[model samples]
Target: MKDRLSAFYWLHETQFAQISSNLITSQRRKAIDIFETEGFPTVRNEDWKYTSLKKLIAPNYVLPSPFASFDEEEQVEYKDIKKFLVNDIDCYQVVFINGRYSSWLSQTTHSKYDICTLGSAWKKYPKIVEENFNKLTKDDGPLVQLNTALAWEGLYVNVPKNIVVEKPIQVLYFTTGSTPVFNQTRSLVILAEGSSAEIIERHHSLTNHETWTNAVDEIQIGSNSSIHWVKLQHDSPQASLTQHSKINQEKDSKAIVHTISTGGKFIRNNLDFSLSGPGAEAHMFGLTLGNDRQLVDHHTRVDHIAPNCSSHETYKGIYDDYSKGVFNGKIYVHTDAQKTAAYQQNNNLILSEKASIDTKPQLEIYADDVKCSHGCTVGQLDEDALFYLRARGIRLKEAKALLMLAFANDAISDIQHPSLRVKLSQLIGRKLGVDMSTVL
Candidate 1:
């Protein structure tokens, strides 16, 4: 797998020469060398102890074409992509087809602030791209290094100081093909001090062919600013996604992330937050539903580098069939981070006897004056409650679905966007419908 990816890198450098600036080019150089040396993550790595990359990377996957050229009959329609979008939400849309930008289906902007693609950002505002690109992942793992080595099409959002974006931005990546494909996508978001914005991102596969996407996002939030980021992972069973999102927060800045994982053969999420400035706050919430031999794993880190900073995380999972789930979260408080408050919780429901979950929430506090808590729970639905609903004339499947829906709703109820919450509620219902026949 490493050799195959190296061939792609050499082909690119040989064909296109330099892709970005001297600094970014150097980053690519070092990244490829590291990837060639160490290769992908394995079970020996502490962070990836529970998840295995053997099956995920063993496929003979080919890199997607630069131009997502499809035949006339194979063309994509708005209706084909519309099912994945939120209903009646006023937003700026950014759409990509097989890692290539699709202008016709996207509603990008440049009137006040930039909500465009990374390629456009490099061509127009090269300075901004150079300053923030690949900065957060310098010490990251080989998965991130591989992305830096061969980064492709993704979005870029820049909300200047004190300017609030008029509408939310929706970014979607749609993969279509009959052959196995491997893609690398990266995005950068910069919110100047006192500015605020909201963004939604999703990756979908239109076919059952094998599709693997390794994605990375680097976001910087300035002082007195706020950002709401949402990730919707619902794809075909043949799809596999490994996502890494890094967020940096300044003084009094706020960032909230919501991960809604509904479907996929294999899904791994690594969410990291750095509270660099005092009074910064970070919130993370995730809801995952796994069935039919699926695997969903989430790992998060919050570093309290400054005093008066607080962070909260809540993740819930419902797995049926032979599916599995894993959650490992960490909160680190530096000595200088006095008066820090951190909270984390993970809850899961094992609908089938064979289904299982592994959760480990940790906290390392060096600050003397701090309040922190971590806990996890794994169990099945309450038999008494199920009997009450069944006695009230509800069918067994309906009763179980209702109980699971109510349990899953806790993680998403805090979402500030009404339309997205509604859409996700609908998606969760549809997701649970698949298990209605076997959940009991």
Candidate 2:
């Protein structure tokens, strides 16, 4: 695979090599070397066993440039903006059209925190980007390298020490243009010591044309800090989306990530957490609602390198039609990480006879005193529960919907914000045709 370089190969390679040339050190050069040796992961790789990148490799997409800006009415389709008015968020909003940032649509307003787009940030704060931009993640992965080489517009967020952001920071990425435009956006988030904030990163497609969005986010949480990261992916069904996020946590720091995927023909999420400090905690959570022939794959890995660290992950999926879902979760505890605690579980509900799911939950602990457990369960709705609800005067459809809602309620209730949680629950109920939002 590494030797096979099609016409599109040069398109990505030139950009990556040029970017590496801008850096003084040999780190970026080494990454390019690794990328050349080990192209994209195939089915043979355990990490990419279920999800295939064939479509991404087959249709060679063009790197998008700065396109037209969204109108006020069209902007409402994004999550952060309310019409033309900006909501009171912890950090500023960075708007991206196609795959590039729009300076006209973006404002320089900052909270008590620091915020800037990657393009503007690189010009103003080259030291920060040089010091940390690609430090936390690896470029060995083909898509990672591809994103690095072709990254056009990105967001850079920095939280001050000991300050708790009062509101959530939202970043809106909109995809437009025709001809399977390729969107490779990168984001860097730095949480200072003892700081806390909630971040909402969303991917939305305005047009129904064929588009591909490949995004990469690198987050670093300082000592005693906390970050709540929410990823809401709703792209066009004709689009293909791939997102990868790598989070590094320090001592006493806590990072919580939740992902909700409902759109796109082929969706794959690679969420990795590295606990580098003792007493650090990490939580990985996800929910996916897939129908038709859509495919959604979630692969997560949490590595506990320090002593007394903890981690927990739970993901649930509901599939209908001939849709397929995949969940692969692994918890790894180093030998020296004494007293480590880790737990992982995945549960999937299949709605149709043709719907299928593949789940694998594993724990690899070298420490003898650590406590770790992992498991996965795949099944259909409970007929007994449905019958019981129907016997109590509820309709069959209503009973099934109610049970499904109950199964997903735990995850929805875990959301810290009340209004958002309620809204999501109601929407879920509506999707299931329960119409029991009033009671919920």
lDDT of 1: 0.87
Q: RMSD of each candidate?
A: 2.6, 3.8
Each prediction's whole-model lDDT (CA) = 0.87, 0.75
Position 372, candidate 1: lDDT: 97
Q: Which sections of candidate 1 miss by over 4 Å?
A: 14-18, 65-74, 434-440
Where in model 2 is the C-alpha error above 4 Å? 1-21, 24-33, 66-92, 103-108, 433-436
Clash counts for all predictions: 0, 0
Please state the error at residue 144 of candidate 1 in Å.
0.3
Q: What does candidate 1's lDDT look like per residue over 44-162, in tens digits?
A: 99898889999999888867745334544335789998888874889999998777788999999898899999867866887898899988998899999999888867989999999
